[model samples]
Target: DAGVTQSPTHLIKTRGQQVTLRCSPKSGHDTVSWYQQALGQGPQFIFQYYEEEERQRGNFPDRFSGHQFPNYSSELNVNALLLGDSALYLCASSLFGTLAGGQETQYFGPGTRLLVL
Candidate 1:
């Protein structure tokens, strides 16, 4: 009955560096989504994973990608990072195709804040 969770709550990197953030989906959830939230903006969708494959992606560049594991856990990998990549990276979990009132329900994990210095 574990909840959605992330690791290494905070991170620091420099330009051109590569970083990988981890996420463990909530118990019984099979889909995982990654979002990036800036200082004062709503979260921007990064990508989503289901069935151990990337099923959907946002408008981010090729540098951003992720993977879903058989255990339903996930990872967000950002390569060639820039200062603009600094943000609170959030991980949200849902039941993939199960919708309530025409909307999918998601459980979000406390984000891993990334700072590109």
Candidate 2:
């Protein structure tokens, strides 16, 4: 029962550059969501993918995008990064289905810490 996992515990990028982080969902789960957590702030949803399509997304810009593969794994790509993009990128997993607002229990990974220059 491997839980959700993310890569490059830490990453460094410069303004205008791009980066891609990966994630593998927990066992028996099919939905993957990406989040951004700044210092001392709660996680902000970026988007969610189920059945290989984006199902929901927050207020993030087009610079932030993602993909989910047949293996239930995911990747988050951020292009033209900015200093504000320096934050922890978190990947969470939930059961395959519609989650009720404020009721879904999301299992989060340790996160990929990104630092932008």
Candidate 3:
């Protein structure tokens, strides 16, 4: 089956602009997680959604927001973007497939490359 997928494999935006990135989880997975990875750093969790509700979030600013649709697809929106927002945005899928929901493993997508000028 296809793993997680993200739109606009690459994007470029100016500072203060707003951008929205989309993600579709793997089939059978109902949870989605967004992460941001700087050029030289590991991926940092931005937020997570399950059942169309935001179940968890990381230490990201309000400018970084997201939503999960009933279909388990997700979108990450960044407003008033700054150069610091440039990074590789990754989406991971997990759980809601087999067994009861408890511990789960996440499979990450290739990620969308975003650049803020």
Candidate 4:
């Protein structure tokens, strides 16, 4: 019955470095999505994974990638990171079927704070 959980509550990296964030979905949830929230900006969708496959992606560049495991946990990896990548990375979980009707509510993790210098 636990809600979504993310690792590394905070991180610090230099430009061009790489970082990986992790997440564990809530019980009964089968889909995982990643989002990036820059300071003062709303969260931007990065990608979503289901059935251990990427189901959808957002406007993010190829540097942003993710993977879903059989247990429904997920990981978000950012490569060649830039200063702009500094933000709060959030992980969300929800039932895929509920999304079809546009009524699904995603439960979000506390988020990992990334600071790129």
Candidate 1 error regions (>4 Å): 98-103
lDDT of 4 at 34: 92
Q: In model 1, where is the ten-residue run with the lowest total lDDT?
A: 95-104
Q: In model 1, what is the error at residue 17, expressed in angstroms?
A: 0.6
Tens digits of per-residue lDDT for model 1, 1-117? 888999979999999999999999999888899999999999999988989988888899999988888999999999999999999999999887745422278889999999999
Tens-digit lDDT string for candidate 3 (1-117): 888899989999999999999999999998999999999999999988988988778999999999999999999999999999999999999984555533288989999999999
C-alpha-based local distance difference test score of model 3 = 0.92
Cα miss at 76, model 3 (Å)? 0.3
Instruction: For model 4, state the Cα shift of residue 6 in Å.
Output: 0.2
**Which tens-of-lDDT digit does each residue in 2-107 have in candidate 4?**
8899999999999999999999999999989999999999999999998999888999999998889999999999999999999999999988875463326799
Clashes of each: 0, 0, 0, 0
Quote model 4's TM-score: 0.94
Off by over 4 Å in 4: 98-103
Question: Model 1: clashing residue pairs?
Answer: none
